[model samples]
Target: MNKRLVWPLWNLALAIGLGAFGAHALAGVLDEYGLGVYETARNYHMWMGLAWLILAVAG
Candidate 1:
């Protein structure tokens, strides 16, 4: 793999890992709306991270 490829790959992995962690770790602690907000943030992070990865590889 290229050196430039590493950052996005790590970011994507981090986003997935963190999203999973947030989902489980905050399940009982946060209320429904709060959890929804957290999930939305996670989803945005995941999407943006993947986008960066794709852009990095393509550009």
Candidate 2:
């Protein structure tokens, strides 16, 4: 595997980990408003992570 490809994969891995953390570890700890904010941010971060992976592979 090319070294350049590692970064995007790492980014994707991080997103997945964070997503799980937000969904599980923080699920009940935060209030509704806080949870909403976390989800919104996580959603965008996940999307960007996906995009990074796609571009890394295709570019």
Candidate 3:
């Protein structure tokens, strides 16, 4: 509930939401290669969000 955590938490939530959107809404829209790229970026985003969360908590 700390204000410092808000941005990191929001980033995490947005990453999750975007992942879900790509999986479902864009399933048929993107081809295999495009989907793979999207997944990779999403994974990175998720990881970065986690890192941010950790930094916010530790700092």
Candidate 4:
């Protein structure tokens, strides 16, 4: 695969890992309100990162 593909794949993977960590670890460590914020931020970040990944792959 191209380097572009590899980089985006790596980024996508990192986003997934971070999102999972936030959900699994932060949710319990933080209070409900804080957890909600963390989840929203991480979820958006992951989704935007995925969009970038798709753009990288397509363009």
Tens digits of per-residue lDDT for model 3 on 1-59? 89989999999999999999999999999999999999999999999999999999999
The regions of model 2 sitting more than 4 angstroms off are none
Runs off by more than 4 Å, candidate 1: none
TM-score of each: 0.88, 0.81, 0.97, 0.73
Q: Clashing pairs in model 1?
A: none
Q: In lDDT terms, which candidate is top?
A: 3
Residue 13 displacement in candidate 4 (angstroms): 1.3
How far does residue 22 in candidate 1 sit from its true spot (Å)?
1.6
Q: How close is each model in CA RMSD to the real structure?
A: 1.0, 1.3, 0.5, 1.6
Angstrom error of the Cα, residue 30, model 3: value is: 0.4
RMSD of 1: 1.0
Output the TM-score of candidate 1: 0.88
Evaluate all candidate structures by whole-model CA lDDT and list the values in order.
Answer: 0.88, 0.85, 0.97, 0.79
In terms of TM-score, the best-performing candidate is 3
**Under the 3 Å rule for N, CA and C atoms, how many clashes does model 1 have?**
0
lDDT of 1 by residue, 1-59 (tens): 88878988888898889888888898889999999998898899889888988899889
- Residue 16's lDDT in candidate 2: 83
Model 2, C-alpha of 45: deviation from truth (Å):
1.2
lDDT (Cα, tens digit) per residue for candidate 2, span 7-58:
8788878888988998999988999999999889888888887888788878
Better candidate number, 3 or 4, judged by TM-score: 3
